[model samples]
Target: MGEDLTYLSFRVIDKKGRAHILEITLDTNYPKCPPSISADVPHIFNLDWSGNSKLKDAVVQFEHHVDKLQDFWSTLDDIDRSLWVVDPKDPHFAMSYRQINIGNDCYITLSVNASDPRSLPQCRFLGSDANVNLLRRKWKINCKRWVKDRSFSENLTSILDIELPQPPEVRKDDRQTECGVCYAQYLPIDDELGSKSGSATDYTCENNNCSRAFHSVCLRDWLRSITTTRRSFDVLFGNCPYCSNPVAVKIINKK
Candidate 1:
């Protein structure tokens, strides 16, 4: 059991020797009802339950599920550690999409398969039209070189023909530039496809020493809340949260 008695969590290691967490939300009725499951998996496993099912049964099922995803997790871990991933700012175990910066104002998003991890993944390129078109051509030309035996990074290098930027081994700032107010790049409006999306940051402080960026919507709300914010015709003025230096943002119109 976890912090609360009804919330139980267990660790399951995949064949590759990586640990994953599985949490079960028990129904109040216990054995008579099935428990809900949450795990660090690409897809949720269907629970096998009956009146005879015990609390331990859920953990056992999740452990078996982890075994099937060994290769999937292994490939993703390599990609994450190998590249300068720009989106999903903080990578989590459950997400399968990776948006990596590939230089020249462009990013390439890869959607890897959970089952056949070594296969060429579905890809989409983001950035200026010129860069996207050029990247697509490179992908088409070099995709046939992808080998299952090679690591994801190796295959990507062959396809792009460019040196990829690895995660900064040493950096002055390790913090993600999430909105200082809402503190997230994307927010889910609902569990289904109706979810709303958010941009990371549009406005940055002019002070070079404190170049903190913030989502305009989040900054507007925060500025409005503070009595010190100055209101102009169509702009709000305030000091940067980190440096106390002056900053301003235009009022976004809903119409």
Candidate 2:
């Protein structure tokens, strides 16, 4: 409860070993009223409070809620580990939507149900019309075969009827920081150049489905070459090189 008597916190681990911090904000009339609940899960939980309900009761209810979503979380974990997830570049436990790359500029997006995860999810395919049509046909034929016993990846491979693509392992020597434009982790700096820390990739595409990175200098130059690019102050606005999504990069002046 820290030094304040109105606030309380409890740490609980799920059945699958995920740790969560449950925070409670108590009112001036704590026992008389129910405290608000906050956690790392995707959605909010209404407190089942009564006159006899105590702080301990809230913790139990939270645990039960989390336990009920074990299948949901496990499904997501398997998808994350097995597929090349391009959307939500950084995944958090709360995010239920996922977009996975399926090669040849094709991608599949899914909104998994937290309550009944093993069942078929809301699915959509993105890409050329021809590819989308083919994927839709495959889904129509294979979706009925889905089973809870199979993992998400296994089910997807069979349903899609195509081997899913995996993310490539970047060369260990340079880590995975290479700029998508220059294809190098660090810009070459000569004594005459006297480059700064900005040589490293500094800007990333904010598009949910495409998160390509680029050096500020490299991106600025690329954006300048585009006939349709726009500029306001020190920022250049243009489409991303790979995904053609709207992106903006600040042109910081270097001394």
Candidate 3:
């Protein structure tokens, strides 16, 4: 293979919060290993983390396309045994493999991109160029993939969705007269049907007129019934449900 192979290295975090440095060797001896076929493989190296954590819970999975070698081992009893017999030079004999280790979890996947390059009836060794090139390029790409753990300071803006120009303060409006039944505020009702109760509450709706109030459980039940039945209320007590003005019923969520 000589200089036909290329090598790539990657730093991976396993499930145990341990870091692993992996090296992959690719054989770039084939014509199919050009940039066109390998572009998609490089972008798959991105890392996504759900929250503050250094370890990955699962092993990496690999996927690839098989161009040929459709029936190279149709008559073989054992697939692994047949793999050893297939000629490497076959253009239809494309190969892609990936291995990942996450703590104690490990996985290995393999596939073919092509089969026979010669297009001959009998199996023929097309040459070492294609096989070596394909392997080298694949290994080179995979070994370069890495995932890094980010700190809160580095990712705070993204998590909060806004930059802090000043320190956050406790707003006085956050507190409201919570209902005794449900211990929630008497706010606008999102649902219109089902259980409803006449109660006094201080919670206001987005619409200024609708000043209706209700126990939390009553409002919750009413909303649930309306949603389940897919119905709407026209007017509540002859006033706007939200602004309490002389208007029609509008759905609002009772806090």
Candidate 4:
């Protein structure tokens, strides 16, 4: 098989706490040609010469595009500016967004061009054609400034100010019923939806001293992965995934 094409991927966050996946590709004819770039949803990249000349020149003229891309990724990581909402544990590229002015659960991808690290990236939407068109139009009218200054850190600081400049608003209910395994509030319906149909609802760690709750699916998976002496035939039991305490599973029927 032919060697895979050389490319790079980045996880960047916008001012609205939205995460984007930036994929840059350099073909065999690179330097003589500009590198290709793309991003995730509500795509509004403008790869035209006027907006993305720097990125074009960087890939076309310099043989160091590889190093430059790595440098850019390092910068985002060091500044703590990379987007994490998609996959909190490890950095794998996926698309999702929090509720914003536009709408929630609207998936879109931004196809962008990055010539150099400093020059603005030019992008346009690539997936869910109708949604992308609508989003691009809205972005062009209201978020021109935002699109023009697309540096990862620049947008991150702006979002941090808007989202956490003040203390987070704590919900009384959440405080009382946070999931111990994920330290997140249990959403029964969401748990049910994620689990095998009619299997079980979410679960709670049954150690009286450890009142942490967990999704039944999460607990089962954890039990399967961890090494433990507690077992019945092939079944396995282990300490609470959260606290290092003994735990028992309580399967709730889906409502």
Encode model 1's per-residue lDDT on 36-155: one tens digit a residue: 899867999999999998878888888888877767766776676567777776456678888887777788899999889889999999999988888899999999989999987788
Decide which is better by lDDT, 1 or 2.
Answer: 2
Per-residue error for 249 in candidate 3, Å, reads 78
lDDT of candidate 1 at residue 168, scale 0 to 100:
50
Index of the highest-TM-score prediction: 2
Write down the lDDT of every candidate, Cα atoms only. Answer: 0.74, 0.77, 0.29, 0.41
- Model 1 lDDT at residue 159: 93
Model 2 stretches with alpha carbons more than 4 Å out: 1-4, 170-255
lDDT of 2: 0.77
The window of 10 residues in a row where model 3 has the poorest summed lDDT is 98-107
Q: Using lDDT as the measure, what is the rank order of every candidate, best first?
A: 2, 1, 4, 3
What C-alpha lDDT, on a 0 to 100 scale, does residue 193 get in candidate 1? 20
Between candidates 3 and 4, the one scoring higher on lDDT is 4
List pairs with backbone clashes in candidate 1. none
Candidate 2: the clashing residue pairs are none
Q: Report the Cα RMSD per candidate.
A: 15.7, 14.6, 28.4, 16.5
Model 2: lowest-lDDT 10 consecutive positions: 168-177
